[model samples]
Target: MKFNVLNLIFAIVLITNCDIAFSQKLAVIQIEDLYLTSPPIENKKTSISYLVEPSDNIVIQYYTCILNDEFSTCKSDDLLSSGETEDYSISVSIPKDLAGKYLSYCISAISKSGAYLPSENECRSELITNGDIDNKNALFSYLNQTKNFSLYNAPITDAKDDVSFVTSNSAALSLSSEGDASLIGYGSEVTNAPNLPKAKEVYSMLDGFAIKSESDDAIIWGQFDTTPSYINQVEEIFPAPYAMAAILKDGGINTAGDMVRGGSISSEAQKRIDKLLSKDGLPKAIYHTAQAFLAVFDMPSGKQKLVAWGQSIYGGTLPDEMKSALSIKDIVTSQDSFTVLDNDGNAYSWGHSPFEQHQNIQTVYATRYAFAGITTSGKVKAWGDSYYGGLLSSAAIDFTNTNPITRLCASDASFVAISDGNKGVAAWGNDYGAGYIPSNIQTELDATTITDDFHCASTEKAIALYDSSHLFVWGDKKYGGALPSNIPTFSIANVIGNNHAFLMKAMDDVYAWGGLNQGGCIPDGHQCLSSDDSSLNLRSAINDLSDISQIGSFNTFSEFEEEVVGGFYVRGSGAVVMWGNSVPDGVFNE
Candidate 1:
């Protein structure tokens, strides 16, 4: 039915029906992304946003139940005002008692006579409650959304007065319903800011000695100071000096010492790196420690150009003779050695390697003094300073010739791998005081993702994202395995092991299961932990944080301190939270 707004104003509007009725109708194409400005609460002015439709009479309404459910109250009739803009918004006085809950909305170009528009995804996210999420990255994957965010309150860093729940899928952010902007409050200004990269390509990293690569929102993580000098005398190939990661552990090997920013690699060397990484080789990142510096494939072209700081300024800078030599699928650099995985399913070692074989390798990792590899067929391989680890040739199993290993992880003294197609886990190394895969690790892999590292004393802690979608750890009864058993089992979205463990849950919360002491690892008294000190229990480290969108590890071994392993997470609110080391810093809690 068709009726103009002019006639509708003369009569009162009700929830079920309207006064006018006509034969013609207006169709609502579709409502794009919904940007919620008001914190999901009642009794305050709230805003909902969407783009404009061709129809002159666009009505936006909300219902008590689902928008699909009939007989719901009209939140506002005049909320669809987006003057001079393609985007539009509706602002209405919110009723009290709707805090921390989802609100459904409906928008339509219905006849003035009152009709609903049937659209795809009709009740889908027409409204999203800005409440905390319990599972940021669940296995069944609720949102299946991998987001990276950074929060900013112009006048203040933590301005929550006029909050907006924004996501990467947003079309445009609106500050208020003041204009045709579909956004409300401070968020509109945020989207309109200059140089904002659209979705997908939004994340970036910048690091280099004197020279660095960056985008508009690039965040400079870690710390290194250096002068921008290169080659025999100085070549400012990189604009910034020591601007990024990869500072050599032994700076004395370079002629310019720590002052040297970066060096050049042979064009031919670049080609080898490209072919080796093949489809997986995106862009080689800088890698180094206090004693080594490597800018793999360092050139404008993704060709031959890899340079390392060794053997005098550019030690391992490949010569033309070795240009087509080796294609590396992946690279892992320990404090003094490097393990390169070849595309042909083989492993290669240089500087220091305990074993010379790399047959059918799938993935590789290096501990402070040892190396480990997983074969495509699902088997484990090991080498290097075995120390207390049975990884030595004398071990009973044939690690070198083993095959069918699904996954592999390493620590300073031990090696762990998944076998039986992830049906079980096996560990070989020192496990006296640290975590060792309890005999059930094989059964543990049934529905889980492994995240392990050389925890305390090569603790060999086993951390996994379980089938139930919760984070669980075991191994050395002294490190992660010793976590309290009473920790909640809601959802453990992401985890990283750094001699200790850091677990990220939904709703901007982070937990840690680490401490040098024998007492509880939780800084605050734990609420849900078992009394048994031998059980693996995680303690809440930080809570009520911004929603988490992404998780990653951040480790630096040189200058910072001894074996300081940490991690970083991106919150839906766009804040970066870092945890590691006991040192004090404004960017992260030590």
Candidate 2:
């Protein structure tokens, strides 16, 4: 039999497969270049081609590997028949996580008997460059894949070689050149050339020569000569030449010889300066100037001082201390009537002073109608009608011609007197029922002072002890004798009498009995009164009030009178309140 080499080769492959009953033909698979639909050329779907032999029943498989780990294995079954050679292609999805260089799979045919043929491999074409190449000349060969060449180990040359030189030293040129070169150098050569106009050169030379001449003139005048020209030249060179002269003068430079030796003004000129300094205003100016100069030069002066002139009336540095001192003596109310001391040390009264009860005055007595004052020398003076019976009468049985009476008091028709030796209370004037001095009070007792109210009929019922807090009552029980069952045991602070009796407790709260309309018992809240109850309506008129510190009344019948034409007077902290018959307008001046 005549045999073609290609047919003989195919027959030998068939004969080697005959022992297995069915020939398992071998095929070669190749993935030369991978194409992808997505950007980053490596990321597109990959299709593979394979060469299949005749009589081969082949299956193709596809797989992707990640981080050198196998991920997906897929197969296309029965792709080739026995003894036939063919090309087959398959596509695979590129996994998004598959990056950098990877060994992508292109697997060959598997025999019909379920045996896989070996797969062919290719060198890893990079999916991504991994930044191992020079960036400036990195070719973006496929718009996505980068072709990086090894650059650092490459030989350096001035010209391009067989291997393309990405970077060349030929692009650089020297910046220096030999003689008479119009092209000075490479790079920024145009900026470095020396260029000057002829006019500028001439002007520069003239300016330099002028400066040197001026400098020489300054040196010659300042060191060699003493003429006015030289002085003016020095002044021109050094501004404020007086300051320079001062320095020179301080250095003891005087004559022309001294000036030639760079010295200062003479001793005679300095003496004139001293004389000027001794002058009044001149010294002050000089001192100020010196201080200013020292300050400007940052120099210190041991005796630097500031002088001021003025009288230190309130002390040089501290303030003065001078204040006024004053005090209060006695407060006289506007309602108090006027009374004068007579030549015989007796008290003479006048006016409608309801506080004293209308009466003419003679000697001090214990009668209720009368109020009297006894002199410190023991002389007695009396005034007003006698209220406590004949206690003020010169004919009383117990009454002695004592030279001096210490004190005396009077209630309704009653009077009480106190001498250094004896103490007694008496009653006289208009009696309201039992308004008389008690006989029980005639006991021998020493009294330092005595007081009574002629206006209160209730006052005639009781006599208050001098130092003791006890009260002695000997008359009718109808008036203030009806003490409340809960009367507090208190020391009597005071007893004020009007139509009623006002008992002031030690706590200053006042209690009253007998009458309320006569302004007798000034209630806690009521203050002043206007008219007497003697006219039409029998009601007492009271006006604006705040607090009452004291009150006084005269006759009981007068206090209880149906018509009070004249009313009570009251005093308060800021002003007085009056509402009686004779109330004046704006009495407070407020």
The CA lDDT of each predicted structure is: 0.35, 0.27
| Candidate 2 C-alpha lDDT tens digits along 1-590 | 44332232234334443544342663433232322212122345544434444325554433333323111121222111122223365554444544443433333333555343333322111132221111211111000000111111111112112111110000101111121112111122122222211110000000010000222221111112232222212211111101112112122111121231112333433454344334321211010010011000100221111111111210111111100111111001111112322222323332222323222122333232234444423334445544434224552323434423433444444434444333444433344423344444445222323332111213434333332244444343433444444444355544433323334333344444443343333333333232332232211222343444433222222212243322233333444332222222122311
Model 1: residues >4 Å from true position, as ranges?
Answer: 1-257, 260-290, 294-307, 311-324, 353-357, 360-362, 376-378, 388-403, 420-422, 432-435, 439-472, 476-479, 506-509, 516-543, 550-590
Candidate 1 lDDT over 195-244, as tens digits, reads 32222112111121111122212212112322232222211111112222
Superposition TM-score, candidate 1 onto the true structure: 0.44
For each of the candidates, the C-alpha root-mean-square deviation to the true structure, in angstroms, is 21.0, 61.0
Q: For model 1, where is the 10-residue window of minimal lDDT?
A: 137-146
TM-score of each: 0.44, 0.26
